[model samples]
Target: MPEPIKVLVTGAAGQIAYSLLYSVAKGDVFGKDQPIILVLLDITPMMEVLKGVVMELQDCALPLVQEMIPTDKIEEAFKDIDAALLVGAMPRRDGMERKDLLAANVKIFQEQGKALDHYAKKTVKVVVVGNPANTNAFICSKFAPSIPKENFSALTRLDQNRAQAQIAGRLNVPNNAVKNCIIWGNHSSTQFPDVSHATVTKNGVVQPVAEAVKDDHWLNNEFIKTVQNRGAAVIKARKLSSAMSAAKAICDHMRDWWFGTHEGEWVSMAVPSDGSYEIEQDLMYSFPVNIKNGKYTIVQGLKIDDNAREKMNVTMKELKEEREMALAACQE
Candidate 1:
């Protein structure tokens, strides 16, 4: 038998975790034959529900080995893990501004970051799924001075996936053919899904959609709105939060990081900055990326139009503001 890959999933009791844990265990994301050791990390209060999930996994008899661990100590949960899905955070409540929310999440990720520094494997690739994910990733990466900043990223694959699905429906093509769609900037309303570069391949014909739908002004405006606000749309229709798809996004984030990006396509992830496209160094904003050798590399050199550039600059500023605000709080 080969060495088993150890995957640590935080927020194991989350709605997203419900789909995530079972899917990974049943080999839907990772290979069916690949042996895995799953460490489910959650707060101690969630022990009972976590135990129930573990029992279900046991019944499935997956090729993977699963373990349940309810703990508030992130250091203990992440030690020696190959991949850590840093999910679950304090969701915003009424009357809370984005700055307030960012400050709250910074504290949690700060502790987790310190834990990762002290205990996680040197090669650990972390994906932050919590709200304000890019900023949360910033705290973790900055705190873990030993880890390469590039090893840390936030979940934007869901945005990419969502963009692809929406494009497929509008263009009437199978999702497999929609290649190279990119979501740039914060995973919020400010995010830009640049379908301007998308290509749809079907029936032995490859269609360039950036031009095909360029004239559909209504669609151009509506598609962007739909892609950006799809989260709210789901919540409105379902009358609950988005747990299943969010969980799926976490899986996609990890799966691509470990396995591979498509030959000609890359997904979006918020990664530590090297000042690309004038993004401030270390902002942890989302960029198009290709993963290799257990790491993610930003796909630089893509042309950024004025509109795209302006949108990204706004989100970058938002991240920097959040960072500075957090820093000020730390000082106080």
Candidate 2:
């Protein structure tokens, strides 16, 4: 067997990590033939809960997990890690403003970024899954200058998955039938879920998703809002933020990054922008990206109609403002 790749999960005791770790240990994200070491990190107060999770993982007796280390030490968690799923961040509290939440998380990610720069492998692949993930990822990349910008991404895959499921449900087809569901801009409600470039395959005949749904009003308004607000809807129905689905999306995001997307297929990832679609450079913005050999290149030359352009600008503005706030917080 080859040497195991080290994967780290922060907030290892959290519900999403609870759902994710089992799948990862079973080779759901990385390939089944590959061996891996799991580094589980959380706050000191959560160490006991994290230990229970480690015990549960051991009970499963997963063969691929060569070693498991549960710790409250950031440096230990990040050291030599090949991949990081940054799931831990301050949750928004009742009556807390958005800026306040950003201020809290900026400090957390900034410190983690320094750890990654100082200890993690230069090739470490990072995906920020916490709330305000796009800005958080940008902050992390800012601090970890040695790690290539392309190596860092945020979890827009969940938003993409939600868009696909909504389309599939509307068309009464399998979720796999939807292709190229693009999530543009931030992960928040301002995101533009563009079916303008998406397609639905039914009976092996591929048709544009808009044509299949055949409801422009619904597509332009209801579908967009539904995809953008799906998280809130899940929270309303379950009285908790999504866990199982969020875990699945995290796995999918990492899997695609480790392997590669299929031919002519693209997925949403919030990667640092280099002025794609007029989005500000250095902002972590979601774009349809195609991956190959563990590297991602944003899909280019997609036609953005006037409507799509307008919506994209709104989300872009939000991210710009978020970056400004996060940077200002760092100064305080």
Candidate 3:
């Protein structure tokens, strides 16, 4: 048997991890043929909880999970890992400001980024899932100078999933019918869930989203707002942030990233920008991307009409401000 690859999950005791660990162990993210070692890490105070989580995994007797290591030490967690799911970050309190939340997470990601640089494999793939994920991912990539920028990404798959689901519900088609939904810029409220290039298939006939929806006013307004605020809606309904759906989205993200996207389709990932679509350079901005052989290239040359351009600009401005705030936080 080939040696098992090590996959690290930070914030292993959190709610999202609670759901995520199971799917990963069942061979949902990586292929079923590959064996994996699960390295679970959380803060010192969460050690007991993490231990229980680890114990549960052991009880499952999953064949793909060759070994499980639960740790509170960052150095131990990072060492020689093949991939990292960076899910930990300080959460925003009820009365706290956005900058304060960014400052708190900056310290966490910077430390983890340095650990990734010093300990993780050079080819490690990282996807940051914490709150303010785009900015946090940018901070992480900055601290890990040696790792290629393409090695890192922020989780915008959840937003993309939300957008696709909304469009499907509107058109009375299955969610899988929606294709090429693009989420532009940050993971925050300013994100532009664009359907300009999206298409939906119903009864085996593919039609552009605008044509199928046939209500530009609703598509331009309600649809976008619903996707942007879906997180809040989930929170309000459950009295907790999304866990099951978030975990599933994370799995979808890593799975597609490892294997490649299908032909003629693209997904949203917040990766370091190289001025694609005139977005600011080096800011972790979300764009439609296609992956091949474990590398991602931004989908280029799509025409951005006036409405799409305006929406993109709003998200771009927010991401720029976020990058500024995240950099300032790094200095502290």
**Whole-model Cα lDDT per candidate?**
0.79, 0.93, 0.91
Candidate 1: RMSD to truth: 2.0
* Runs in model 2 lying further than 4 Å from the true structure: 93-97
Question: Distance (Å) between predicted and true CA of 113, model 1?
Answer: 0.3
- Residue-level lDDT tens digits of model 2 in 1-332: 77899999999999999999999999999999889999999999999999999999999999999999999999899999999999998765444566777888999999999999999999999999987899999999999999999999999999999999999999999999999999999988899999899999998899999899999999999999999988877777877777899999999999999999999999999999999889889999999999999999999999988999999999999999999999998888
* Model 3 bad stretches (over 4 Å): 93-96
Q: Estimate the TM-score for candidate 3.
A: 0.98
Model 1, 57-97: lDDT tens digits are 78877766645455556667888887888877875443456
Residue range 62-111, candidate 3, lDDT tens digits: 99999999998889999999999999877644445667778778889999
Candidate 1, run of 10 with poorest lDDT: 211-220
Which 10 consecutive positions of candidate 3 have the poorest summed lDDT? 90-99
Q: RMSD of model 3, in Å? A: 1.1
Q: What lDDT does model 3 reach? A: 0.91
For model 3, state the Cα shift of residue 62 in Å.
0.5
What TM-score, to 2 decimals, does candidate 2 have? 0.98
Instruction: List the candidates' TM-scores in order.
Output: 0.93, 0.98, 0.98
Segments in model 1 whose C-alpha atoms lie over 4 Å from true places: 66-72, 92-97, 214-216, 330-332
- What is candidate 1's CA lDDT for residue 87? 79
